[model samples]
Target: MNNILTLAAIYRQSLFYFAIRAMTILEPQTKLSRNWHQKAIAYQLMQCFLGLCRRLIINQPPKTLKTHLVSISYVAWLLMHDPSLRIAIICYDEALASTQLRKIRQLLRSKWYMALAPATRIRKDKDTETLFETTAGGEVRALSVQGGITGHGFDVIIIDDPQKASLAHSETERRHLEELYASAIANRWRNPAKGVLIVVMQRLHVDDFTAYLLRLRKDTVHLNIPAVAPVDMTFHLDDDEVYRFREGELLEPERLSDVVLEELRTAQGEVHFQAQYMQAPVKTGGCPINPAWFRTYTELPKYDYRIISIDPAFTENGGDFSAALVCDVVGDDVYLVHGEQVQCDYPNLLRWIETLDKTWKPDLFLIEAIGAGKGIWGLLRERDFHHVGTIETHNGLPKLRRMEIVSPMIEAGRVFVPANAEWARQFLRLIGSFPYGPSDDWPDALSQLLIRLRDACMRAGQHRCRRFPPDPPPQQTSLRYGMHYRKYWL
Candidate 1:
């Protein structure tokens, strides 16, 4: 009679049911709120389980129990249905991977779970923290993102927060992880055509792995849920059902009240809050200088001096980019002639400098005296490039502060740039998003040029500065200012 009762109580078919039941055991003390986000994720996982979604990406605010829902409860649920499902959960490191593994192991041993699925039991001989198997042939593996997955093929691979928040901004780390996923995780599926890959994490940067995968694969389904809805977003769960969120609506108001969110927004700053909680990663605009302040020029005016400022990459690896800006300074107006940023080794960097020097024939060259810059500067001197000069440092002020000192000059229209140059768009984007943009090579070079120019002019007693005529009403939004404008020449 007890065996029949246990078999009758088993709810092994529905992942949502199993997740809710497991949640009661995992988060025993807290009052868990089953919100819309959970339902949406459950549906998406169900689709993956049913062989509908091959590649799934979940982008949501952090501290929302995503790992629990997708990695632990969901995996346990899947095992109950098909104990033969080979699963691997990958995280930033072994510790994180093991943490989730422990949770799933605990949930599997809970009395509620045993009562529901009495037939499913973890094999005692194969039981371990990071790897385990069930009596019915299912297996679960936990490993780090950088760890190798040799001789192992998984039916469903779940990558939970594959990157640490601190390292997400590093291009080298991002690239390494992206390559790791492509070479290691993505190809480890037992069946290439029918295998499932699910990634769940908060959006870190615009160029992070999540963005990279979305760009590389066109068919991947992306589900994004922000803390507060920015617009009326209709999430199509299926042909008949939809999860619609009205503008300004909170994702889980019952648990994360508006007051709590507002406090977070205040404490963390709007830029961070938007990226970390709203899932809308934006390059915040507290930059000391605005790109709109610099006037555009159609043709170069007479120039007394041509100068090129170089900010060399810190490493030989293809990580930080080497940037060079060519400028023509006539009186007080500094015209930006050209700019370029490229990932190159020291040899390529030296070749690039020699080429720019030969082509532009700038009278002066200013290079930052740190990292690879110092070596490049020495090489230029050894090669008899007498124009090269190291930029003077100011008592170790932050980059933002150094940029701040030049903000007034930029805002006063002392800098003139080509109106429709192809490179100008990229330069302006970097400047507009200054200090926060993906790369700082351009901004650093530009700032170095301006500061050196100002100091040179002041020392030479060339006090007269030419201000370009007022720009005509813009015909279209200027890419630099997020609005259109017409160009003017002095």
Candidate 2:
């Protein structure tokens, strides 16, 4: 073991070696596991910590040992190389900052660390928990982002989890933190050009510090490690080094295996899981349709009725998408066969609907009677589309209200989604965010489909269609209705 340590000490140029060695001594319970995600993070963090890179932003899932390696252990590694390198650590609060300070202190006390950096000794004079100094004129100060460091400057600064999760969606709090980062924290470097800054945290919102920094600092190196890899994006560590993963590859399965991650997704639900574990936080709540309530089907059941639901855009541009969902109703259950959200003019939308009708051969074409949707209904009626129907929007209620009326059918496990469809992921994202999402077209289209199914079933005396209002008769003539299909009787 001594000989191995001697060799490791000689080969301490690699940050991975340094991190594992430090962890081995300081955190004995942590077994040495060679996770690729950790290795990539350590390398990039070391580059920034060593002043090779000016800034680095790492957005990874929580409990991935992010704070342990990047914030706590790396500071000790820096001291080993240059004991006089001044460092400052900032977190959401002073208590959290002190926790990291204690971890660093523990590492510095390890016998292994003593052998690695024999010249570095704690300055007996300033050896407090939150603020400490080494004999070589260097110091590590731990403070919160709001904690004033008026006269202090650091050679390397680490902002670890600066934004608290509780205040993630508060606009005022988020903006205030951004202001402090720009004015107070960003400028407090001893040497501006040579100083290093590292940000490590899970994504809590779309406008969190990570997003703000990336938008402002285009040159900042970013490492976004989602729990499940979304696509084939490569992490360009350097010129010759890159880390690539398949579409659904798990980031760190050894520590967070597929089974474990699935449990997390189930426990946290889609909204929280996407933000905390998936690193794709959006500004939204539980949304209208809870993804957990969506029943998935590997194969479709026999259906007596089918409809192509449409929510048309108001214009060719600068409006919501012209969304559509092809649905099949079998008994009490409604199955979503296909779904899409696209931007197109009336002509294009007509063509797209024609293609869907040809493919699905739905019994009726159910179009929402509102805005540009009125035009769609008119065109379909004029063209004599077989089995075309115009469903009236109740009192011109908001799309949100319409969606709420049909959300319970989904929650009751009466709506089944195609398990193998490529559109499933996008559909889940849209429904998970609902009205707060960028576009409400997809969910609206879904609501239209489910409402039509339920209303039709209710008229036939089927108790399965418990929610929603009565379905209005489909308009038979284009010349009968005006621009806005107002109900005459009501």
CA lDDT, every prediction?
A: 0.78, 0.77
Candidate 2 structure quality by residue, lDDT tens digits, 1-490: 9997776565357666777777776678978777778778877876775567888888899988888888887888888888998899889888888988888888888777787789888888988878889999899989887675543789989989998775666667789998898789888889998889899999988788898999988899988889888888777544478878779998877778899987766545455578889899866534656787998999887875677888888557677788888877676677888898778877888898888877887667788777777878888877867367877775555666566566656665778888878798788888888878887888888877766665666565646542323443444222322222221111
Q: How displaced is residue 39 in candidate 1, in Å? A: 0.8
lDDT of 1: 0.78
TM per candidate: 0.59, 0.59
> What's model 2's TM-score?
0.59
- The residue pairs found clashing in candidate 2 are none
| TM-score quality measure for candidate 1 | 0.59
| lDDT, candidate 1, 165-240, per-residue tens | 6566556788999888878887898888888999999987767878998998999999989998899998755547
Lowest-sum lDDT 10-residue window in model 1: 481-490
